[model samples]
Target chain A: MTDDLPPLLLGRLNHVGIACPSIDDTIAMYARLFGATVSTPPFDLPAQGVRVAFIDVANSQLELIEPLGPDSPIHGFLKKNPAGGQHHVCFEVADIIAARDAMRARGATVLGSGEPRIGAHGVPIIFVHPRDTGGVLIELMATPDHY
Target chain B: MTDDLPPLLLGRLNHVGIACPSIDDTIAMYARLFGATVSTPPFDLPAQGVRVAFIDVANSQLELIEPLGPDSPIHGFLKKNPAGGQHHVCFEVADIIAARDAMRARGATVLGSGEPRIGAHGVPIIFVHPRDTGGVLIELMATPDHY
Candidate 1:
């Protein structure tokens, strides 16, 4: 059955998501230590219930996210890990809907409504459940139009 | 003092380590689902107390690791997470010692003996603690001679 499936086009890793209590502090640390180029001022994503900033590296990015409010999705994660930690990893895909269907056909679980929502990069993204991803929350995002 | 420092040269990400109870199972999943090209057979790294396999991607690799024995460092990780999960992320550096010194100067904690140990890839590698890295266990390795 698996032999009949088409190739899964998991594109390059776009960014790694890090859950931090304070994006400013993390941005400062990255800048001071690694001389990293961090994106200015975290912007709110009410839909995702978090504020996010991007720290650009040579090949990829580190996304720092903080809970937006009490009802934020990452609030529980922050409470459990007050010091912050690696949240999820995002991978780019040329076609998100195709990726979603392929993953689902292979028994991978897609989180939320099983639909791609606009992510911070202004591209459609879907989260694959951790259980199916060997304990990593995997976010599959369509490559931004600009990219 | 920080203003006078040169920019840290963080190379492309090398791989993301996933700790799994069974490398065979994970390899099968990646191959069957993602049509990933996994390295043939898992190799034991007795020094690290783990067996490792690689799944090649376009930009980076996915390292699937399993405990070598009872004393394996990842034994406890698997015990806590029976189903397995993301363990660490590795990045390449031109000079690991210089990277270590810079990180230490900026108050980041290096794990183990604070020295580079020969990693599975046969290169000098050091682990930066998650506490200082926004909760990600970051491995910095000197780029291989061939790379």
Candidate 2:
């Protein structure tokens, strides 16, 4: 099926999502160890059931996500890992809908409602199932407003 | 303890390592699904006990690693996952020794013999323990030649 279609317009990695029990501790580690500047006061995403912050790196950002509550999506992961771990890796795409359609055409499974929803970045985003992505939950998000 | 020490010089992400049972299947999926152009032919890193390949993305690379044998370090990961999963995430550093020392000073545990070893990229590299890295095994490698 390798035909004349253009390659996926995946932009630079926006951020890597790390699920942690305490965003404060993680932020402290980055600050003390790497001198990373973190976005102030994590904001809660009730729809996503997580609180998120960003640690600005040289070229990209590291997203720290903490479960908002027991029913949070990342709560199960934190329960199993306790200390938490890499949750998902996000990449930027020029057009999220086109990316989703391309993935769907190739039989890739989009998670959740299988439609693009406004993500934490306030851009359209869709998650590809881990099974279809070699066990890594992959999130494709439209390029951020500033980018 | 944020004292009078220099911060770690972590460069842009070099790649995200994915441990896969079959690089061929993974490559095919990326090609068909994302039209990703993968580097041709997998290469063996005997010392690392894994076969590796790279899929170049717009800004970074996706490293695909497969166990070379039962003794392969990734063998255990594949056994647990059966399919495959994200194994590690690697970032480039300006200096290996400086980064190592900074991490050590900050109480981060360095894996292996506690010294940098030649990694798959033929550059000095060290793995930081997941315990100290928010449950994510982090690889710090000297910036590759020409990169």
Candidate 3:
């Protein structure tokens, strides 16, 4: 927004995160309905406290994540929604640190520890507070295979 | 899910729909944060009872829709959510009817008259009941232009 700083190197929408109650059921539903391809099989990411899978779409992908343990954000979301729905939208950025700093300068809050963490896809990412982004949690992922 | 039917012609993820209270504010937020470009200008689609705009992304787009009239679906969404959030994920399909029929045969409910309606993007689109799609409102958009 400001002329002083350069634009953030934003790439494509990498994937849309869908909070799923059962990755198995979700995979079955999409596969049966749309013949969706599963690029990533279901596996537990203990660090993120979620079991995750990726549904390959033509352009981007859909990430299905279920809470693995208590106190996980996905668990909190499912408890609030119960029906499971879109959780967050992850967009690729060329430089993670630059995007983070630029967003902060523009008054956006980076969630968690404000440091890049290994995301569900094994790429470094940071979550921008939903409060700052029209009440939608947005994850900025570093592309071209992270630093 | 049935193998008798040929696979539905699913295309790329076309756009993700985001309900907005004010298109102006939404555009401003994305621009200031990520230098996001506006692909489609704000325009009122009275037929759909909504005001719509498209934000450009590398691979796809974000459709920002606000309630134009009181009974608009976006109006109901805003009322239910209040803070606004991701409303639906739209995927491009080569053939709309075949896709709809495939879903119906598989026990998925197609919203409205079970016919493709002109969507916010002026393309033929239909909504599959969230109940059938893992609680996420899914929009199947006809691509390569429509009939």
Q: Which candidate should be chosen as best, given TM-score against the real structure?
A: 3
Docking class of 2: medium
Model 3 docking category: medium
DockQ scores for all predicted structures? 0.55, 0.57, 0.60
Best by the lDDT measure:
3
Off by over 4 Å in 1: A1-5, B1-6
User: On TM-score, who's better, 1 or 2?
Assistant: 2
lDDT of 3 by residue, B43-97 (tens): 9998788899998789888899888987787877887777789999999988889
Give the RMSD in angstroms, all C-alphas superposed, for model 3: 2.5
Candidate 2 chain B: worst 10 consecutive residues by lDDT?
B1-10
lDDT of each: 0.83, 0.83, 0.85
For model 3 the local lDDT of residue A8 reads 42
| RMSD of every prediction | 2.2, 2.0, 2.5
What TM-score does model 2 achieve against the real structure?
A: 0.93
What range of 10 consecutive residues in model 3 chain B has the weakest lDDT sum?
A: B1-10
